[model samples]
Target: MNSLFHDRVRGLNQAPLRPHAQYVLYWSQMNRRVSGNHALAHAISLANSLKLPLLVYEALTCTYRQANRRLHTFILEGVPETAKRLAALGAGYVFYLRARKSDSNNTLYRLAENAAALITDDYPTFIAAQHNSSVPAKLSIPYLAVDSSCVIPMNRFEKREYAAYTIRPKVHRLLPEYLKPWDMPVLRQRWNLPLPAFHTEVTAGNIDALVASCEIDHSVAPSLTFRGGALEAEKRLAVFLDRNLRRYSTDRNHPAAHATSNLSPYLHFGMISALDVALAVERHGLENNLSSAEFLEEMIVRRELAFNFARYAGRQTECLSSLPDWARRTLLAHATDERKPCYSREQFERALTHDDIWNATQKELLLRGKMHGYYRMYWGKKIIEWSPTCQDALETMIYLHDKYALDGRDPNTYTGILWCFGLHDRPWGERSIFGQIRFMSYDGMKRKTDSAAYLREIAWLESTGCEPHPLQ
Candidate 1:
């Protein structure tokens, strides 16, 4: 059950290889990077064993829900680097950009025409989940969905965990065996085959034009702060270790301190692997006498807990039924207890609520495509407080994330939203609109952190049309 080599591989379809195929096909779905990638390594190994060149196929289609300029640009930003890395590793890279609904949707099927085996990323949510379930049966070659997303492969968990505490001991115990560094396997054969007809070469100067050519919604703009891709991800991580790791424990909960690693978007996109990040942080922490235990816990234990839940729950990941019996009961009991103020989804979206702090958080989400982690809890809690119902609040949160957040639609995103409804959480003292669910107060946030500073920072960004700390 080794995370890197054994348990990471999951056989989906019972199919034989294509006879006299030209090359092995590797589909980059979620774990999009070339290094610290167990799936890519597996693809290379199979290709080497079969004495065939490897062809890596990656695609971006404008057909998914809420397809917009922001999402398209971010994904396109990673393509140039991916092409460079795959070429350096002696693998042929084919990038298919399906720009419209009319564009041929059969790129994968077309690429698989002469492939020996089909290998793709094993992911729990979004389009990857749908593809893994549906595409395997259609292919004539062996289909594999490798678990390259987790530091410890999600298959290591036998059952859904109740909470972080229950999974913490088990995860820590397995950490030593799986936590070491992994280098991508070298390939014996170089890809020399002509690229497929559908391939589109991505370049830095043409990303905007390429995204503009897509049929996705053009209204939503790219993030004002974060850039996408492996190089950008690596750069941000080095910056975090050099400056912010020491302050992570003490000031992580404060929004304006900038004391935390702003690596969630890269982590979400798989541009940076958790295994790589953890190893670097641990080395830096030891050398500097700074404790990285807290950061590691969030990165490993809590993050994987989300994966475990998503892997086990299936389609119920977004449904409220995924909540525990206690949570459902508590939320149901207080469903009708609201009376003071109820706002529509539009109000929440516009940041029209009475609370300045909550509005600031939403503005951050709107302008930067992500919000600070600490205030994000406040943002969710306030939605539950102001919206017409808990379900409404849930829908609003999911909608905003799906549309705007760089890290939205992830397992952690859904799990964190559900945490506001008391999922994976214990019952707390009863209140009017919240029942036994744990409640966060405005006074509590104001007391523990300097809200004024955060408000000022966001105000500056909103006025200037940029983040206080833009990557540029």
Candidate 2:
């Protein structure tokens, strides 16, 4: 393999490549796109070196924790584009939809049976993380995991970073070398074999029917706002560059402004690469004479800090125990603080809270499958203030995100939710329910943000099932 991708790749197993293997298998566990994928590029390099055809395998199963119409539809919608791209690259493509728990689950192992070496995505959280940890040892051939998710590879940081400030300088120091465009290598050998029997063909028209046929949660519908696939992701990125990049630094925190790029779902699902977005934004900013600093801070430094947290924290990423000493002690000290008008999980899920701002945030998650970052902080803080206990509040946040947010079960999701409980943060003035943890009040949100406009927008979305404006 080329030394350019050395830091991004990690060999997960000791097994040698199968001597008589027909092709190299690249499993699309995450980093699903054909462009800007270091793992796929690395696989092509390996395949070319071995003079073997490359085969790419992707799957969506009903077995993951919150399999539902919303999640399944988004993933399935991306399949046709992926198939087309892979085919154009002269690589074989296979997508398997295990619509039922009883369906065959040995697809990866079966594919590996003929593989020279197995290449997969190296993600720090969600199902990808779990699979990376356990699946490597089970494979007979070498299993290599690549860090294609971050602009600066996650492996560069040896330990969990304390905060964005600690990691920012390091990220900047390395940006010149890592932020350049990825040159995906051409395949030397073309795949000519027919696709496997388990391959489930996905098309733009059959996505809804495919999602409907799945025996997963039927109640939660697809987002009324965002669609899945690389095409949609690219379109949204183009819109941000043309209309919103200049305004992003000023109005990203203001939910109603719609200045921020609504690309978290794309990022989480790997439909779009962070490197691709960062490069585009930086180039646009340079040509147009606008500062990309603020946007890149969130994209690289802060976002990678979350990946660093998940990398070291491991299974504790979602738990309160992973919090710093000050945060845990402070929360434990205030554990018994009474929550006036406390709410149950059901009430929170149904958006039945008395706080209009909080309810609006929840409604945004329901309708758009994501909430604006600024209000999400308020939404989480209010949940901490209203739930019966701190643990209950954490559970509510995770449950809601897992069930509704398109960006749920992601490193950013865990980091953002845990931010409500003071992870990667400092102590503030002592408070009632929140103690030293920072507090967000209804009046504070009203004073700082365009809460009235946000409420009006959410109300319109709920009533009409459509975005109130073209900007959104």
Candidate 3:
């Protein structure tokens, strides 16, 4: 058999194997599902080459910064389902470790004990990358980090890309080779290694079960409307492909239309892979359609561009200070303009103050765990205008996004917030409250879109009582 091992860097690379090793270990992090998983395929191939079984271990540690209820619940939902899927494929074992001081240590030691070679998911911005980088140094076994998240592995673009237009062609050139569907490897032989008797200190519970037990911040609760899991992701994708995709080109900008794919939360949680979604869209044979192309552009090109930025850009969380010099200069020049009315971060978060449309957008983000793309841009730009300083605007924007949006704290969120400061955007004629940074206003939104329709949609969500944050 051809050697199953291949060198791939998603966010980080897998470690070189030692001479004496046992079974292959997959330390699950970002990529959670069994289906259409490149990292899982790589690990399976390594195990086959080594003539050993494969073990998948996931640790739900609470120590990581911003380990909130929303993130925890989304991750927990996939564990048991993944465990069952692994068993069906005749993989060695699936272990889920919940957050507990004793359990966290025990799970780490257990993986180190059984693992001959370790493979983990590569994520750049969040705690996952920190763990992947730190854990390998402590272990005697070799660790490999696989790049499974992006359509094109992030390292392929050595530097931060300028825009989607620049990176789109580059990714298209490589897609023919990398975009082929991954086939599940048939496990030819089963090793009869004795199952370890060490008890899993972490409890294997559902999202609700785990959330109730967590000591993390509950101020921002799970959205009743948005539930995370592979099954739910697949259903949402199907609905989008079948319905919204046809009008996506023309209607995606209109928040009231419900024409865009709502699969972002699923994508953020790693419940569904981009390749899986792409293949389904291709199978639909809608490529000739303009709307289909537009949808794919957002999914494959724009979304991956966000990933490319987070991967290559240092200090992903730092605001306009980290942007390119041209962007920074333009923003600072316009920073001191007088505003008609400025709102505080507290007013924004509570969905208070004026502009019913903006307030509606905030409420939607809070209740639905998402905001319409059109409103999202307007939402961020308004923050730049309203805050006392551009820096404060950036900080407040990141805070609200990370706190409420399901797809918040993602590369897209980072890039989207930076967009207000002119990153990936050209300088405009200088103006107060915005200077040369691209400006988006409530009035401009009204001129460009059906404002009443958008407002009505928000009213409908309010009537349904879908609250994103807890009552203050």
Candidate 4:
């Protein structure tokens, strides 16, 4: 096998470097955190090799699909901490905010003019995937996209995985080799260049105004439950280790138990690295005479499975055409099956359904920007159950996630959404609209989880705009 460094680095363009360049550019397109970042470290190595300083560029534009207040606020919340960290590391930080449709889109090209080589996150989904493909062709210097998104480099998998079981053994075998901490680079040459004119200073106090100034949709508010940043990610990890890890094996499915770490938004935004979280869980488990098996499984195995799927799925990641053969056949076999009380996309979006628990799940997505994993399963299954057609259900799930979820447009988000339509899942017993695709019922959810407690908790959040069990 190749070295992890080599495995992670993929050359996008073959152009030679600019000899008189002032710095090496590191673009934080996906893995936005400063520490435990392989892409950033790789950039540092290149900078040190070239005897040049490093400059990190990040941006939030108004052009992405569903660029709303919720997504904007979560990303901007992490910017201040990122700026502070990069400053301490002696690297130049440029955060370009293209808040309006007419705002300059050439900040990257302009930044590239001063750099020897450019490095960016080798992410598979969303805008990063698009950039990694199109941006390199336009650049004159060598472009490298590095895989910091997965602990084991995503390129190691030759083909897309069918299920968790198929990928688990391979992942475990590679874990010992790659699942260790990364040492971030100490800059040899400090950045001395004057800040670019487009550099938008982002502070907590100004985040609201900045977001408000954006030409994106203003209706969808920021997440009611989660905060975004490296500091916030660390806090959630600390809370999980102290209060949740012990019970995670047994109580994670119980939503009100709060046994799971609420780090999905942070992870999705690259505010925290999986390596750091995994190491912390392992250390805490060893010290406390407890097991972190379940947490590790979910964090590394299941999480990376989603990444692997997205890495291969490409533009069809959100479509029904991506489902497996069995899933397709099963759903097709029952296409004409009768429907009962089908709902429209607006109804699903508004959480207007007869089932209180399902409504609560949608409400959580509406208000909190996420829902407990167990309830999320029920939420998708019921959407499949109630929507006018399977296609409509798939569209509704994708639309809602893209519009509302802080973690949406991520590999995990797409995989989880597709999983509802039986992608990466086996067919179950024949059923009505679902046919052989897996079916979830309210009774099954209630039996397996603390649905009442979850319902009450969600209701409390709705009524008071305050969580009964606050993450703090």
Instruction: Indicate which candidate wins on lDDT.
Output: 2
> For each predicted model, how many residue pairs clash, with residues at least 3 apart or on different chains?
0, 0, 8, 0
lDDT string, candidate 3, 160-183, tens digits: 788877998988887776666767
lDDT of every predicted structure (CA atoms): 0.90, 0.93, 0.73, 0.90
lDDT of 2 by residue, 253-276 (tens): 999999999999999989999999
User: Could you tell me how far off, in angstroms, the CA of residue 459 lies in candidate 4 after the best superposition?
Assistant: 0.9
Clash count for candidate 4 is 0
Deviating ranges (above 4 Å) for candidate 2: none
- Between candidates 1 and 2, the one scoring higher on TM-score is 2
Candidate 4 local lDDT, 1-472, one digit each (tens): 1244898999999999999999999999998899888888999888988999999999999999999999999999999999999989999999999999998989999999989999999999989999999999999999999998888889999899999999999999999988776577678999999989999999999999999999999999888888888999999999999998999999999988998998898899999998889999998999999998899999999999999999888988878888998888888887888778888898889989999999999999999998889888889999888887888888888899999998888899889988988987887888888888888988888888889988998899899988887783
Candidate with more favorable, higher lDDT: 1 or 3? 1
Off by over 4 Å in 1: 1-4, 470-472
In candidate 4, stretches whose alpha carbon ends up further than 4 angstroms from where it belongs are 1-4
Query: lDDT, candidate 2, residue 80?
Result: 93
lDDT, candidate 1, 1-472, per-residue tens: 2335888899999999887899999999998899898889999988888899999999999988799998888888998999999989999999999998999999899889999999999999888999999999998889999988898889889999999999999999999988998777788899988987889989999998999899988988888888899999999998889889999999999888888788888888889888999999999999999999999999999999999999998899998899999888988988888556788888888899889999999999988899999899999998998888888889999999999999988989999999888878899998888888889999999999999999999999899997677562
- Residue 369 in model 1: lDDT: 91
Query: Between prediction 3 and prediction 4, which has the larger lDDT?
Result: 4
| CA lDDT for candidate 2 | 0.93
